[model samples]
Target: MKRTNEKIAEQFKTFQILDEEGKVVNEEAMPKLSDDELKELMTRMVYTRILDQRSIALNRQGRLGFYAPTAGQEASQLGSQFALEKEDFILPGYRDVPQLIWHGLPLYKAFLFSRGHYIGNQFPDGVNALSPQIIIGAQYVQTAGVAMGMQKRGQKSVAITYTGDGGTSQGDFYEGMNFAGAFNSPAIFIVQNNRFAISTPVEKQTAADTLAQKAVAAGIEGVQVDGMDVLAVYTVTKEARERAVNGEGPTLIEMLTYRYGPHTMAGDDPTRYRSEELDNEWEKKDPLVRFRKFLEEKGIWSEDEENAVIERAKDEIKAAIKEADNTPKQKVTDLIGNMYETLPANLNEQMEEYKAKESK
Candidate 1:
């Protein structure tokens, strides 16, 4: 049965399977994932936590350039990616490292990118296509274009674009939705409504009641989900993808979440605006802690098992960081070499001038 507006709103507000005490609350909606799958999710969450922490530490130590930590948003990232098909294209924002990792991007690639490696954007052999977008809302239109291309080719695959709440305010957001609606393109716009866009709160971004509701203006369905609840996010995203594949047009999803940490290592201090009390409150509702409690209630989690998973992930992430740091840096000529098949006259002239200067 199609969910009614009341049910949808309720699900959006709260679809938690676990309580703060690590207890299962929503038995029916509790994912039927096997013990192995649950363990894998937990392990991935741990790995993401470690990677985020390490990356932040590296930035502080001058070993990395800028870093965006996804520490508190692992469930939102992992669960959404898990709901996607292998052939589906993902347009990810800078803070979505966990989503890329879930899509099979190696940890080394993320480390390389964090350290300013250009080759990190190049997808590895046989890897799913995912190049991180640095511009706030640019990926929205790009993903819509990709989905339009897929529609033209009669492909059933969909494109899922991830962005922050602040991105929704950009003109590209509306343009993408309009285009998708006009052509019934296979696309899903996922707004990870993390409450704050850098230091600006969501209240300043818009007053549309909710971000998802904006889809109505574009003539598409809009849905909101409790992003902290992995199961909830997966359920809604999977349904949205199915709708797109079935030619029902695109769906806009606003995932209500919070960024517990600073926007990025290079950004303004979050403490200047956000209260530390609110941060502590969010920590109490940490997705990992909630999910673990739910799993424990089902007799599927153990302390020993969790410890082993953490230990293994720590080793893997440490190795990946080392490999990324050790990888050879790109040569100076790589900038010109990676360009189009035929260089423009202006570019050629600049390159020649640069070479002449170097020779002198």
Candidate 2:
């Protein structure tokens, strides 16, 4: 058993491009992206960091509802999303709003979703994503189904989903990968293993040496990557997407990342379960910090450019919050009505009854 675990671990060595000091350790693994493209990736990460900060503040002030902070996982989230075409489907977990927004979900709608407003679930034309799934690992099965649909339609698009280390323990995670592999579904399952699932550290989540190795049971390809290295994340995702679209079946990517904040704005306290020293250690590997150094070394990024993006993000976030605030209060009737295309007779009556009461 020990030897078997060791072999799996050896096979799934963590792929990394940039090291902690923002130096490229694996030159061969560096992604081929234009300077502008690199800057855009940095911009997205910075903007998302600002967004996470503002969201935490908003949640505190009672202006927003449930929020999962995305501070340290920017590279893992945006880097992968950057590899996706707009047509690809994204089924994100509650912590993955950044990916949804980048994939074309309106920022205002994301804010609305956090506020529990019905409009938040309403995607505009051309946006191909489901709202962030709050139930852990639920999106896994859904991604498999969506990918199978894409395969049947002979579309080149892939279905992608994100969950955390804790989510890997869920049955849906395995079922999704198994179904996708069985049908050669064009799916990408990403596990952002950020060391902890709420108060439970990942070590306590499972006995497996690594989450990526779990893909072997489903007969799918799996690999772990340095989630702090944006370029590495993007490179791996791009390859996985290519493999998916080319009928090579699904790939399960485990991003070795971290969340610098609590699990959620709903009262998770990381300090209660983790150490300040550990937090400080992950901070050294902050995605934005290292990616910034890499770009700066190439003369493709500067503090001025980053500051501008930060200011723009702040402005946009302010406007989005205002728009969310201006939205009509979510009604029970709206929820019931949107729950189905054709409401059942019982639900139809309830919808009507609620509509009447709401009107009053």
Top-scoring candidate (TM-score)? 2
Question: How much is 26 displaced in model 1, in angstroms?
Answer: 4.0
TM-scores of all candidate predictions against the true structure: 0.91, 0.97
- List clashing residue pairs in candidate 2: none
Alpha-carbon lDDT, every model = 0.80, 0.93
Runs with alpha carbons beyond 4 Å of true place in candidate 2: 340-353
Off by over 4 Å in 1: 1-25, 349-360
**lDDT of model 2, residue 311:** 100
Per-residue accuracy of model 2 over 1-360 as CA lDDT, tens digit each: 988898888889999999998998999988889988998999999999999999999999999999999999999999999999989999999999999999888999999999888889889988899989988999999999999999999999999999999899899998999999999999999999999887788889888889999999999999999999999999999999999999999999999999999999888888899998999999999999999998899888998999899999999999999999998888898789788999999998998898889888
Candidate 1 Cα lDDT to native: 0.80
Residue-pair clashes per candidate = 1, 0
Model 1 error, position 248 (Å): 1.5
Candidate 1, 294: how far from true, in Å?
Answer: 0.9
